[model samples]
Target chain A: EAGVTQSPTHLIKTRGQQATLRCSPISGHTSVYWYQQALGLGLQFLLWYDEGEERNRGNFPPRFSGRQFPNYSSELNVNALELEDSALYLCASSLYRTKVAETQYFGPGTRLLVL
Target chain B: GIQVEQSPPDLILQEGANSTLRCNFSDSVNNLQWFHQNPWGQLINLFYIPSGTKQNGRLSATTVATERYSLLYISSSQTTDSGVYFCAVEQDFGNEKLTFGTGTRLTIIP
Candidate 1:
């Protein structure tokens, strides 16, 4: 089976601009998760969507928002971006919400560079 | 919020050697996962072992949920294993959000 896939491998935007990243989960997966890996900040959870509902979110600001489609694909939107927003945005997917122990496969991630 | 701490923030080993990385959580967790961030910055899931033990190729992970800790072992480490290894846990009482540790940076010399 194909793994999680992300679009626009690299993006360059300026502060105050908006950026949108896309993710297509595995064919049979139902849970989509977004994470941000900023340099020196480590990997931080951004959002988690299961069955088309926003189940949980990280401590990030409202500017960092995303949604999952019926097909289980997800999109993360960053509005009024700041330089600190520059990082590798990753998307992961699992079979379903059966349990939290299920493995979450990840994508190559989209590197967003805000100037 | 749960606190996750990884030991030996950085390690360097020669190729063909073995290594062990540790992760400790402040609270009990229902989910524990190990990931390898490659040089290209891709987060590759190594294991989702909430309890018991699991192994894949040269990598093996064991999580003692009751003890609130997990361990990752790499046998015969290779140059490809040079990267940052992170342990993420989801607290049983939380919203299922993963709390990630600072990670252990591993470097393997040829």
Candidate 2:
């Protein structure tokens, strides 16, 4: 089975620009999650989507938002990117309701460098 | 918000050594997992142990949910094991959200 996959392994954006990162969940998986790993902030939860609907979001500002597609794939959008927005954006997926598949499988991650 | 703390924020060990990393959460959780972020930054799921103990290869993890803490062990460590290890948890059953800890940086010298 293919693990979670993310696109644009590396991205470069300038201040005030918008960046979009993509993720494809494992087959049959219905939930996707997004996280940001900054230099000192550690890994902070960004958003959570399930079955095409955003279920929860973290403490990030309104500039950070995302949506899940019908296929369970996800996109994280960071608008008006600031220098501090630079970080490794990670995507993960899991089976919606299962005992063994509850654990999330992560992608290689996208390294976003906001200038 | 639940707070997760990892011990020995930084560690250095020679290859073939055994080491233990600890994770403590401030509250109850429905699930707990361990992940290894390689030098290249790929988050690899190491364990999905919410309770009891589970082992994979020379790596094993035990989560004492009742105590709100978990331990990850690396035996016969290799240079490939050099990376940041993270502990994540779900606040409720069927919850897809995860809060991550600060992480433990491990460096193994060959």
Candidate 3:
């Protein structure tokens, strides 16, 4: 089975521009999550979507948003990007359950650079 | 929010040496995972051991959920093992979102 896949391995944008990153979950997976790994800062959860609905969000600003499709693929949108927004955006997926925790597999991550 | 911490922020070992990495969480977790981040920044899943122990090839991980800690053992480490290892956890049961640790950078010198 294929693991999680991401698009645009690298991206370069200027401040105030918008950036969109995409991720496709592994086969048979139903939950998608986004995380940002900033320089000097560890990975931070961005968003969580399951069954086509947003489930949870981190402490990021409103500019960081994303949605999951019916096929369990997800897209993360960063609007009005800032220099600090430059980071490796990773997406992970896992089987969705209400009570049982499932293992999450990650993608290669999109390296976004905001100038 | 749960905080995850990794010990020995960095380690350097000669090829064929053995190493142990540790992870500690501030609260109970329903999910615990170990990932190896390659130099190119791709996170490769190493283990999904929330409890008990599991081994794959030269790597083995044990998670003691009750103690809120986990240990990853890399036996006879190779130069290929050089990279950053991260431990992530899901604090709330069924909440798939992961909170990652600061990561442990391991360098294996040939």
Candidate 4:
């Protein structure tokens, strides 16, 4: 089985620009999660999407948003990007099941450089 | 918000040596996992150990849920084991949002 996959291995953008990062979950997986690994900030939970709904989010600003499509793939959008927004954005997926803990598999992160 | 702390922050060991990394969470967690972030920036899932002990080849992990602590052991370490080890946890069962710890950077010298 193929693990999670992400597009645009590297991305370059300037201040005030918008950046979009995409992720395709593993087959038969129904949950997608977004995370940001920034300098000094460590890895943080950006957003969580399951069953086409936003389930949870972190303490990031409103400009950091994302959506999950009908096919379980996800897209993370950063609007009005700042220099601090430059980081390695990672995507993960898992088969959602209630009351049972499921393992999450991650993708090769998209390295975003905002100048 | 739950806080996850990992130690010793950095470790350097010989290829044949063994090492243990520790993670402590502030609250009760229903989901806990260990991940290795390679040099190429890929987070590889190492283990999904919420409780008890699980071993995979040269690597093993034990999570003491009652004490809210987890330990990852790497036996006969290899240069390929050089990377950042991260521990993440979910406080609730149904809500699966993970809170990651500040990783431990491991360097294996060959």
Candidate 1 local lDDT, A7-95, one digit each (tens): 99999999999999999999998889999999989889999998999989988999999899988899999999999999999998886
The clash numbers for all candidates, in the given order, read 0, 0, 0, 0
Q: Which residue pairs in model 4 clash with each other?
A: none
Candidate 1: CAPRI quality band: medium
lDDT for model 2, on a 0 to 1 scale?
0.91
Q: Tell me how far the alpha carbon of residue A81 in candidate 3 is from the true structure, in angstroms, after superposition.
A: 0.8
Cα deviation of B109, candidate 2, in Å: 1.1
| Worst window of 10 by summed lDDT in candidate 1 chain B | B90-99
Best by lDDT: 4
C-alpha TM-score for every candidate: 0.95, 0.96, 0.97, 0.98
Per-residue lDDT of candidate 4, residues A1-115 (tens digit): 9999998999999999999999999999999999999999999889999999999888899999989999999999999999999999999999988888799899999999999
How close to the true structure is residue A86 of candidate 1, measured as C-alpha lDDT? Answer: 98
Question: What does candidate 4's lDDT look like per residue over B10-77, in tens digits?
Answer: 99999999999999999999899999999999999999999999999999999999999999999999
Off by over 4 Å in 3: none
Question: Which residue pairs collide in model 1, if any?
Answer: none
Model 2 has a clash total of 0
Model 1 scores what on Cα lDDT?
0.90
Taking the tens digit of each residue's C-alpha lDDT, what string does model 2 give over A1-115?
A: 8999999999999999999999999999899999999998988889889989888888899999999988889999999999999999999998878434388889999999987
lDDT tens string, model 2, B36-110?
Answer: 998889999899988999999999999998999999999999999999999998887655688899999999999
Runs in model 4 deviating more than 4 A are none
Candidate topping TM-score: 4
TM-score of chain A, all candidates? 0.96, 0.95, 0.98, 0.98
The local distance difference test score of each candidate is 0.90, 0.91, 0.93, 0.95
How much TM-score does chain B earn in each model? 0.96, 0.96, 0.97, 0.97
Q: Which TM-score does chain B of candidate 2 obtain?
A: 0.96
